[model samples]
Target chain A: MPPPLKAVLADDEKSLCVHLKNLLQQAWPELQICAEARNGVEALEMIEKHHPDIAFLDIKMPGMSGMEVARRAADMCRIVFITAYDQFAVQAFENEAVDYLLKPVEPERLARTIQRLKERFEKRDLDPAPIQAVLKSLQGRLAAAAPPPYLKWIKVPDRQSLRLIAVEEICCFQAQDKYTVVQTEREEFLIRKPIKELVDELDPQTFWQIHRSTIVNAAWIDKISTSLTGSYVLTLKRRPGTFTVSRGYRDRFKSM
Target chain B: MMKTGNKLQTPCDSVRQKDFKPMSPTLRQHRKGLSWKDLGLTALFSTIIAALLTYVFQDESFWVYLIISQGIGLSICTLCRYSLALFNPQTSWGIVAVVATASIFGGMLGGTVGAWLSGIEMPIFLSKKIYTLRVLIMSLLFGSVIAYYFFSRERLSEIRGLLQEERIQRLTSEKHAVQSQLKMLQAQIEPHFLFNTLSNILSLLDSDAARGKTMLRDLTRYLRASLAESRSQWSTLGSEMELVGAYLNIFKIRMDERLQVHIEMDEALKEIPFSPMLIQPLVENAVIHGLDATIEGGTIHIRAEQENGLLRITVADTGQGIASVPSPGLGLANIRERLQALYGGRGRLIITENQPRGVKAVIEVPYATAP
Candidate 1:
């Protein structure tokens, strides 16, 4: 009755996703198998499309890591991070009371996790605040190890040849399934770089993340208006579509 | 009086025993004993003194003056050698006493002997001139001057020897610290790598048993090669390549079909004894920074060539490209340091950007020079 209790799985490795999916069916047979994503961009898209009750996120993946996706997902779904083995990730998850599954996930462990998820959703007392805290701390730990390098130029595959696009020319970035559409004032081009990656690479002061899938250049904004739903919607100076600023990121907009 | 010299005998015996063993045949005449070499040197030195005294007095023969000078010289020289044993070198008063006793005693012995040989008779003692308080006091002054010179020179040289020893000790410890630092760097087989490989092995065992067995074999070889190599200064180029091969093979399984490796090395060059960790870190850098950073992954090409009295080994990768790769400071710096240490300036590590994509690292070391 209640949407058949859906869940989404995400990992770069196809076999790993399949393996986890098979194990998940044994643990929660009643749960509907909605979708599986091979990368962080696809994972975020699946979460948005399905509005699933849970997401099994692999912490390490190219383009966008599971932690980055989790940061953008906010309160969208309950997160159960899967890591091969990261000491800092393990400690952060434990301290934050966020669930994490080590690789080679045993059936018994999966059953326990499924049971906990069912109980939490049934009670509906689970909050997204600790997930936010855990992810922030993990980011800090990762940055301390090696600061994320700023990207100045990105290579975009063109129709017949390749084009090197400078970061300054880009007005906004919007996620399109697995690829990101890089919008410049002159023209819009598509790139395989997910929105999550641009968040790390682009200068945070100029390019602001207004949506899980959209990041807009601050100088190119038409205006930010508060919708009747009390959420901020931003439109670019030359760009057409209005980008919704989710509640998780609205604080950055409201203060400005 | 002479029996008491036995107590003062030990310290001098211990010190001089190690040096000039022939001269110190015995302290049998600690009061006035000398080896023939000592006697000849003493006779020559005393003659110089006797000439001076005879020139001043102008009354006695140089022979009579020589006997007195010889008595004082031999007595003071032999006794001063053993003198410090009875007294602390730290005390001035103790030293004056040693000098006074030896000089005056010798003056009396030689004066009395010379007076007897020359057939002079006296009321209570022979040669009142030699026994005069003036002569005894002068003997004490001259003995003190000579004693100060001897001790000062000895002390200066002892201090110099200590300073030399200290310098050698400091240099040895500095060498030790560098050695330990190298050992620690060598033992840096990343735990994350080990755990990740093991985790993959566990997963594969359940789903793909055949691949699991292959990974296990590769892992075993990797562990053994690394463990054996780190403990030794050098390993054969072939074994090191085997170690690198095992390492990449494990990574291949873990990365799925993403990783590709091509190793080109001459069979003749494989027997060359190369520094243990030189090429391994460069390969690791290629895998982690050059290849692992990209989702599509890439290829690692390792080639070793021997030519013109030099061995050149290069590890080039095509994954993220050189522009995308950040400077991997520690691993590369470590390799350079090792190269410098093992081959001095003869060894070299050169890094360049690989065309199309990735990074190329080359190591050059003299083939004829090895550990």
Candidate 2:
């Protein structure tokens, strides 16, 4: 028998994730599923923790996208992307000859993917360079297609009137008590906008999401301190209190 | 009018020429009756030809020979028109042969009969060979010249008819080009939405047959609505709403609980000639750009009303509040262009921020009936 293998799967939809897990189990009973994640962020943590031989990722998720995750963890394992239907993503994958499964994954197509994965995995084809080129091209294509002007200003209630706060002035955003708390130098005001949407609206270069409920401005970071329990806590320049980087977000602070 | 003749002509043969102008068939096999007006035209042309011949030959009785020669000319014309099925006339020489044949037949017949009639005395031309030969040669020259004139007149008219048909064909093609350009302005389908919906249906087909069937039905309706009306530039408000309704139903099933919709339309405005594709694109914009951008999703409200001879439509949404980057065009420009193409400066589409959040697009046009 081939050496035992482990794989982790990630998808935002709970039903779809379960469906894929079931399909994978049926296809290869001996292969073990070490972990499962509901989004791109958790998928990275699971891959890091389990050191799996393969990762099955969904291309779209709320906070972090699968391509972004693949860019970060490409050297760790072979990736088989799951996408409902994305023109640029599919085109890039086709160009790089990468493995991708269309949604409602047919048994026949999945079998083909399995055969390819087993062959490549045995050949020790864990090179991250070519896959990185595909992701870069895909990113360029998506940017050229949308070039979406990211959210620049957010409004929060200020006394009797509404105020438009420049996104740069804001230090952090956290979801609390069914409302989002927008943090600035002189303000910690509440707004109805949720963190789920802020992940998509804010530019990733300037804003880094460190927790499910929190996002911090990269320029406002004061320092990263390690705790005895082996957790990372982020200290900001303007903000008074520190925020604990969650288990899934520790990779952002790993280099530091 | 078909009774008068000279005494030398046998009674039966002269009667045949006078009364039996048989109907003839054209090249296409359609029968043409020999009408009195046709005969009158033949008589008029014969008189003119005879008058010219009289001047040249100095013979008073040449008119009778000209009239008699008309029969031979008419028969030959019918044969030429009908025999095209047997003969190829695309070559220039073939049709000019019609003039040649008519000239030869006209000269020989006119010389034989004209010599007999112009020689009104008791066989004087038979006694003088030079006189008979002179009259025969002169008649041949004059008959050919006269027949060639009529043949050219007929050819000129045929060329004019051909040119007229070519002009009509050019106009029709120009109209077709204009029509196709408008259709190009119609909605271009987004491949992402199409494939995603198809994938969703594939997934649901096994798990929930009933819901899958419902989605299939809605998709069929949506396709029928969109594809059928695309050929036309104007549609009834009621039918356009039906298209929007089918479109919303498909999304409602796919998005499930993430989407909410509210539509309000008056019954009387349904039959008015509204611009096609204006509302559906706006609704699609609201769903894809306004609601789908946010995780929690939101509601799309479509309202149409007719007030004071004006039809007004609004599609509003409560999603990202237009504060987010607008979708690629979102069919906003298309909607505006179609309205302008239809109404000149009288129609308008306006975009504004929805109450507390989202985007609201409105259209106003005169409630004109079908023109």
Candidate 3:
């Protein structure tokens, strides 16, 4: 048999990297793991130095993105992308025509991708047209779509199931202990997400920046009224309705 | 109204004018002033005391009878009224005390003759010691009753006023808090959005210049929408979806083929109003933490449905699942807090391991109509 296909694995997650390496060794004992890289730049360097026949690339890395590395390494070796993203990037992958594996790297999927890579190597015809089209479509979608920064709903753990909460139904989001709470019209649920991350994605129009630790739904606002104690308080249109906006956020109501 | 006139005409009014003292004290003192009922009760008690004294002194000289009768009646009546004013400041007790004092004194004094004629000595018939004790006790009891009646009536009115004031204060504070918080939450959404979008734009500038131009236009639309309602707290679901679509596109550029997104929403719920930016963060988390960490790209499915009286939205990814590092990223946490602030106890977010693998984030909120 032609000398076992030389390969390299690149990923930031140590456990996953090891798992994939083991799986590869099991599938093709002769396949040599020439080098391992933890990031895109390192992966690129290793590919350049070792000239591996095949490379498994993780899309996101600290130094350089997997795509950036792939773009640079496109002519040098066959690339198989491994990632956890969705269809929005499918076009980009398709444009590359590079074999890709979804995360949790199923053995069967890995085997198929490897088989395809080997077949392409033998044929010596790695067409970049499909990849180019996919990339174009992805870019088109990104350009045309409007980004909603806010989260409209969240899925929470329930009894053996999950609960979906509409963001509008929420009155306030409060950080408590280690978890953030989603307070709504009927109940409250605890979730393990950071406040900063939520702030990044929420829509600016409906969610108000009340304090460092709190975000309020603007629709729930009844009015801005001064407390007898000379502080600002928020009144909700709902029952048992009142929340204090910290002094730091007082300036936020200038327009209101 | 009549009592108020007397207060305004009083010498204290002149003092108030000169001092420019707060009106609260004067108003309170005025409220404590005696009314018609108090005066009537005082007069009745005085008369009964006078009559009793006169009856007791019937065998004594007229001068003695007159002196004792006038002295006791006047002294007791004046003292009872002053006591009513001082002790029962709340008014209800004052009324009860005044009325009770008058009734007891009048009944005892008026019935003395009947007891004397029933074969009993004038002093022994009413039992001088017992009569005196009874008079004192009855006078006190009646005085308290009078004071209580007046006190209760005044107290009820005062309580009503206080309740009204409290209600206003409560409403005012609540309004302010809501406004401030709304502003804060609104403020928090834009910066991160701009940052992420700008990053997307940067990425697109290199690979596809035409797409970058289009993305810039979309960004402008998003910015316009965000600025259009710097003060609005709610938006149509359709508009929010449009915003999410834009955000997803930006991610699509950064993530390239490693990310797949699917949005499944009920057509009927599309018109419903929801918190803006409510769905975008979950999708972001799926891309950044869930899918970004994996070597191979995965699918992010966002599904919205109306079940029971609630709206259920799910963001699921076939990614690396929760990080093995035992800590979650910040995006999911922030989304949860925003939900809580908007819904209080009504909203919920659930996170679980998706079928086969990956993570699923679900949010549920009561269906609310636009105000």
How does model 1 fare in lDDT? 0.70
Tens-digit lDDT track of model 3 for B237-337: 77777776766676565556677889888778888978766676667667666786665668888888888888888889898755342232334545556
Q: List the residue pairs that clash in candidate 1.
A: B321-B358
Error of 1 at B200 (Å): 1.3
True contacts kept of 3: 0.03
CAPRI class assigned to model 1: incorrect
Using DockQ as the yardstick, the better of models 2 and 3 is 2
Runs in model 3 with CA error above 4 Å? Answer: A1-158, A162-256, B1-129, B132-196, B275-299, B315-371
lDDT of each: 0.70, 0.68, 0.63
- Model 2 residue runs over 4 Å out of place are A1-22, A30-54, A60-64, A75-77, A84-88, A121-124, A145-256, B1-188, B322-328, B368-371
Query: Can you list the residue pairs that collide in candidate 2?
Result: B321-B358
- Which of candidates 2 and 3 reaches a greater lDDT? 2
lDDT of 2 at B132: 55
User: Across residues A117-211, which tens digit of lDDT does each residue of candidate 2 receive?
Assistant: 88887898777777788888887754653545787667676665455455766799999978999987655789998999998989899899999
Name the better of 1 and 3 by lDDT: 1
Using lDDT, give the best candidate's number: 1
User: What is the number of backbone collisions in each predicted candidate, taken in the order shown?
Assistant: 1, 1, 152
TM value for model 1: 0.54
